[model samples]
Target: MSELRDTELSAKVKGIEVTVTFPLAHGKPFHAKQAPETTVGTVRSEAMSQFGIQEEANSTYYLTHGGSRVDDGATLASIAGESEAVKFTLVKELVQG
Candidate 1:
């Protein structure tokens, strides 16, 4: 786990705010501001790096929003509705199960 930052991100990342939490990581959650068109896969990848989680052959990491598993291809705009921020939880499980 890493520290959750209250960032004043530059103009390059001014669209929507994103925060991601791990079920059992050490520190705080991952936080950033990203463009509305950013994909869930992108967020997941960055969050993984921030939390120092590695990919595993037997496991698959996924993102969930509002208790429902979110598709990697989905964009922030699709999930955010009329809001300017979004939150997600990161979880890992057996790939074949």
Candidate 2:
């Protein structure tokens, strides 16, 4: 005899800030400020890379675009919000009977 378990995937990425660093043509240490021009997916990839997390097929994150928040079937390419440090909170619950 055995039992079964249930589980789901969901997440929210908040406090997103893309920092760009560069040096002058003269090889001087310098820096610049600019918002990330890439998609949220790319941002996730960047974060994962920063943390040395390999690509896993069982991981996902919730997203909000222009006040429209969705948990599934959305991509960074479709985000319509202005470029800024956007915050998001993810919520998940089991279907009620």
Candidate 3:
């Protein structure tokens, strides 16, 4: 008396390597494996967790690669392409009232 469900997809997601760097003293960059469809915000959250950074409502962060800003909504695959590892800098944005 068991029911069966179909779970199959034609397309598969690939894992991408990413490294995040922080500007704080003694801050070291860390590497993480993520799917190509993963968003920048997800990566930022991981970094924050790894670094033990407390989340602030008024403060914000930005991810940059090669001196270019990466949008939070952008996917890792779109930014890294076929590279072995994508380098990203986590910069804290100054909030103005």
Candidate 4:
């Protein structure tokens, strides 16, 4: 059987949209059914790995889904209040290759 993953997801909290992205190996597709129920931090770590981001940069990521948006600096309470885990399509600068 093939492995499953949750590559992307979105949540709407307080009328805002929050998008999440997870990393998959180059040329290896995600198995949607097997993805974990992750949090905002999880998404960021995935992006960091995919982009070769060093820990010192402390870069912020932007998330968008439907009509809502969230930044990496957003508080967990804020995100939890407005979003839910749902399948989404991920598009990241580093994942382009």
lDDT of 4 by residue, 3-94 (tens): 12122222322222333444533443222221233444555555555555445433334444443654544444334432343333343433
Best by lDDT: 1
Clashing pairs in 1: none
What's the candidate order when arranged by decreasing TM-score?
A: 1, 3, 2, 4
> Compared with the true structure, what per-residue lDDT tens digits does model 1 show for residues 8-93?
22222358889999977999999998887778999999999999999999999999999999999887777775478999999998
Off by over 4 Å in 4: 1-36, 55-59, 71-97
Ten-residue segment with the worst summed lDDT in candidate 1?
A: 1-10
Give lDDT tens digits, candidate 3, residues 1-97.
Answer: 0111111110233577889999872667778988776788899888878877867777788789999889888777677665546889988876776
| Each candidate structure's count of clashing pairs | 0, 0, 0, 6
- Give per-residue CA lDDT, model 2, range 1-97, as digits (tens): 0111100111232223443212211232222222333344555444444444464455443334444554343333233233334443322223434
Give me the displacement of residue 54 in model 1, in angstroms: 1.3
TM-scores of the candidates in the order shown: 0.82, 0.32, 0.77, 0.31
Residue 73 miss distance in model 4 (angstroms) = 9.5
What is the number of residue pairs that collide in model 3? 0
Regions more than 4 Å wrong, model 1: 1-14
